[model samples]
Target: MSDGERVEATPIDPPQPLGATGEWLASCREEVARVAAGFQAFEISDEAGYRDAKRQRAALRAEVASIEERRKSMTRAIELAVREFKDGAAEAVAPLSGLDAEYKERIDEWDEACRARRRDELEAAYAEMAPQLVTLVPFERLAGRYADAGKWFLRSTTGPKAMASLEEAVSDVARNERQIGMYGLAPEEAEAMRAEYFSTLDLQAAARHAMELREQRERVRALDAERAEAAGAPPAEESRAVASARRAAEAFIERDAQAPALEERQRYVFEFELSADELMSLMRFVRANGIHGRRRRAA
Candidate 1:
């Protein structure tokens, strides 16, 4: 075909009749059949033919959609009738909602009473297990710690099973607390272990951590002592003081030796106060250098 010429489309048959809107549907189908029979098929020799084919296809689709909308409109009376029936049924049952809630509340009240009885029984059993543990930590405090751990007071849990679970928890805590106390740690160290136990709930791990810290401190001190001994001196700070004192004494002696034969060794006295550390350093230097010095206590 030429660019301006259109080809004829082969017509497709309409769908079969269905539902209560059959006659109306048949009429709609006949309209679709008539439109389909007249549809011109266009070869895309140019943009104009493509545009005409697109517009015609869209118009066919819109006709079918209008038919569907009318079919839906035919069902609106039936839909409204069903909705009104449901609303009447709902109105008839509306007053029963409060009665239903009341029945549920009554059942819940009985359940709660049963639960309260179970809770009392559990607490009594706990009281019996608590006395031995009370010396280490208060029973109330221990109870509070494990309060949220289990649903022991529920009707589903048997009395003996709940008792056993609670007893185990209480016993474990008491045992850990006693073990920590028996370690005989310093007050601050004990406090740290308690904090660790509270945070992690693992007594053995906390004890191990404390021991590791102690070992590290001991190793550091031992290394420092060995280093000081190898140098034939006190600790680092005291050794520095001793070296300073020795240097000052040597400088004085050298200055005295160069003092032009100082009138047949005349006596010179120097007086000054020294801190405990400085005094000890001065005495150590004097002894090591074998310098004779007189000791006098101030009256």
Candidate 2:
């Protein structure tokens, strides 16, 4: 029989209530059971019986092919119907979904703008917190110094507490700056002090380090002067005792040079009362020769 006739002979209608679909499927199973029983009972003892069984097997295969074709056609119809329903539902809600997405985009942009504004305000506030004399230190430097504290940033920081912390930092920088100037340090020593202050945030330590550096440099200069004087002095230009004292001082400085850096040095304090001209001359000599001197108020 033709494929169409085979399908028409066993029409598989759309599913409905259990009554019609289940009965149709039951009838198909009954037909298969009858065929199976007939094949099992009919023994192929003769050549004629074998030929009959082979013919029946071909018919069974054809029936299975027809059922498979019908099943494919029904499933294709169901899939098309499902796709159409989904497209219709999505069309109904398209405008609302678009509106939701647009609103979210606007909110995100506004939130980012607020965050940018807050960042700018934080930088300005940090800059205002620095001392006016702290010209060398920028806001970036200050922010980096306190960044790990987490309170210096925009979200967690408060006005009064931030001001207090910044005030402490400003005080430190100001004190360090004053000490740097007060010591009348050489240009190299002043730079070293500034470096130490920024690294350790300690004023006394920076000052003490600069003073030690100054002392080392002064000792070298004093040794060089002694050598130059000894080598270049004219005959009888200095007394023997004075020359011997100069050599002894140079040797003492060299011997203690190998000592530990933290060791205390011998300090000699001299009080001078001089006329203005003499004082000016002395000050000029001290500065010109890189002498380490500190003024003391008389009691």
Which tens-of-lDDT digit does each residue in 1-299 have in candidate 2? 46566433456444333234456567768767876675543778999999988998888788788777765765676677667766876998799789999999999888677656655665676566654534566666765666446465444566556656766766666776777877887787788898788766667888888888887775666565545444643333344444454455456566667777755556655555443333333444444445465754356
Find the 10 residues in a row with the least total lDDT in model 1.
Answer: 12-21
Candidate 2 residue pairs that clash: none
**Whole-model lDDT values for every prediction:** 0.70, 0.63
lDDT of 1 by residue, 1-299 (tens): 48899878677433222234567767888987887887767678888888888999898789778877877876775576567766876887787877898989999999999878866776667677776545455544555666456567567777777777788878788688778998978787888887777666678899998888766765666565445555667723555555665677789878977878755655545454544445555666666666675755344
TM-score of 2: 0.35
| Model 1 spans > 4 angstroms off | 1-41, 46-55, 68-90, 132-150, 179-185, 195-299
- Backbone clashes (count) for model 2: 0
lDDT of 2 at 286: 46
